[model samples]
Target: MLYDEFNSYKNFVGADVFKNKATEKTDILKNLNPAFPVREYQKEALGRFYYYVEEYHQKQKPIHLMFNMATGSGKTLIMVANLLYFYQKGYRNFIFLLALATLSKIEGGGQI
Candidate 1:
């Protein structure tokens, strides 16, 4: 249902509405470190995030988004890219939270 809702809205507005609008200075790919090449799917995820943020602003709603991805699917890489994006947009403060379960796994010598 949730995904259907997203698709419905995206389809109504046309898929091109979700494209990245950032210029070179604030572009996520340009700002990313050369050592960490982002995959196409990862870039698509970021574009969706950016699109929703603009939608929220236009609708005068709070900005909220979540990345639903499987483990080892480069979620951390996306977060890093998001940070760079915001940093370029003049955001200087950020708070990053990690789940205790993940921390415990790492502490127990398990693969994250």
Candidate 2:
């Protein structure tokens, strides 16, 4: 059946296939070095984002995530933390983009 076919592709760890399990309520905040106060709103936003990311991965689909945060809501910290979490999970490649008024501002980070 289709279910059996999908199960065959899931990764197993200690007899528990990774696909069969949901992501735990991780202590990602605690693991953050130089941690700062995380407001309740921030926690709710990050939790939803992480859930969607995990769901996409588990379903073997490409995932795209966006965070809509107001100014000074710790967007950078959340981004860095997400990247670090993924990196620790064996993802090596990443791209971070910043928007400017025009295309003229687009350049490699190596250049000033």
Which of the numbered candidates is closest to the native, going by highest TM-score? Answer: 1
TM-scores of the models, in the order given: 0.63, 0.53
Model 1 over residues 1-112: C-alpha lDDT tens digits?
4456657876898764444432322466766666556766676677677656554444334555679999867786688777887786899999877664663554334322
Model 2, position 74, has a per-residue lDDT of 65
Judge candidate 1 at residue 37 and give its lDDT: 68
Residue by residue across 86-105, what tens digits does model 2's lDDT show? 88789999996754343233
Task: Give candidate 1 regions above 4 Å deviation.
Answer: 12-26, 56-61, 99-112
Against the unseen true structure, what C-alpha lDDT does each candidate score?
0.63, 0.53
CA shift at 98, candidate 1, in angstroms? 3.3
The positional error of residue 30 in candidate 1, measured at the CA in angstroms, is 1.7
Cα misplacement distance, residue 31 of candidate 2 (Å): 3.5
- CA lDDT of 12 in candidate 1? 95
